[model samples]
Target: MNDETAYKVLTGTEFAALEAGRFEGAPVDLADGYIHLSTAAQLTGTVDRHFSGQNGLVVVTVDLAALGEAVRWEISRGGQKFPHLYGRLRMAAVTAHAPLARAADGSVELP
Candidate 1:
């Protein structure tokens, strides 16, 4: 949950793509020209707003330091600074990954 790490929520298919070695991101990311990432605080909202009622989702922990200049913190979603990756995501940059889990209040559980 520290600033050193960011989270990428991916569908099962997208995760499979990443496991293959690299990930270009999802449709929205492709359209936006960057991979969308959320902080621990923003994660639940991102999941609730985008992946509600869906299953088989996974949360990938990204090492922001590894991304270096590829990560840009931009104002987004209620004026908060969100991390966006401007290049392809390689498996080497992923610190950890696990299936998405929700709390009793339906909030996303950080991996």
Candidate 2:
């Protein structure tokens, strides 16, 4: 199945409920018995220069550390391995925001 068909769109409330332990760590009710979240590197680049013309000039810089962490997360899930749910739980608490994305088919894309 395609990625879109492989996952479900988790509502904000549902996600919050999952975070609040309402689902008991199995928030996503998938037909496969388990759900997986993964990330992939879409693009990476350095801010070589900012445009300056009739409009205005802007400063540009790259956040290497943030990019690095994103790369690491992408790499960690590249193999489609089920991440440690406990770790993800802790990460959610630390970040205070869920890193959720919607696929073309409207399903929630994990990671």
Candidate 3:
């Protein structure tokens, strides 16, 4: 698992809603009080458990360095540590983004 960086998977529509250099985050994030992030090793499980059978999903790579104190490592599902951001996600902090596409067996590749 990567310790230096994290990823945020969002729908294409949610990604398009990002504006003014910030992302409002998903509804789950709002309810939880932080933007949930996934590690490279956890990406597949996150999709399988929460986003199964979905399409047009976008995976965003976030620079942990940019989040500073706003980011927290929290224990979540399966007792794994997940990155959580307390504030709006800054678009400038994203390094790259790509569509989440599945291969055979319905598994997706992280973009």
Candidate 4:
């Protein structure tokens, strides 16, 4: 993938797991065999569609380069390519994280 970074939206519980050092995967990701992540352009849609009405949400910045071959670009969600990690999401691959924030235009503000 050309993009060097992607974002993961996590619940409070998931964030806690990640903060502890590593995240094996979310339930969906566990079943799917990969961790789901979105590009900056796809962030708002991901939140609106899958995470609506949720509280205590966190946005995590993942370094795709750090993930290396574990990260794959796959076609998903309206035919756009998304980043998926076939391995655990470790803190070493995370660049930053913060509570989810949106601008007046409704786009997510990256931490």
Candidate 2 stretches greater than 4 Å from native: 1-9, 24-29, 40-111
lDDT rank order? 1, 4, 3, 2
What TM-score fits each model? 0.95, 0.29, 0.89, 0.95
Model 3: per-residue lDDT, tens digit, 22-64? Answer: 4688988988888999988888889889888888989888888
Model 2, range 59-90, lDDT digits (tens) per residue? Answer: 11122222222212222323533222222222
Whole-model Cα lDDT of every candidate shown, in order:
0.91, 0.28, 0.84, 0.91
Clashing pairs in 2: none
Cα misplacement distance, residue 38 of candidate 1 (Å): 0.3
Question: How displaced is residue 2 in candidate 3, in Å?
Answer: 2.2
lDDT of candidate 1 over 7-99, digit per residue (tens): 999999999999997578899999999999999889999998999989999999999999899999999999899999999898899898999
Cα RMSD of predicted structure 2: 15.2
Taking every candidate in turn, the Cα RMSD to the unseen true structure, in Å, is: 1.2, 15.2, 1.7, 1.2
TM-score of 1: 0.95
What 10-residue stretch in candidate 2 is worst by lDDT? 43-52
* Clashes by residue pair, model 3: none
Query: If both were scored by TM-score, which would come out higher, candidate 2 or candidate 3?
Result: 3
User: In angstroms, how far off is 24's CA in candidate 1?
Assistant: 0.7
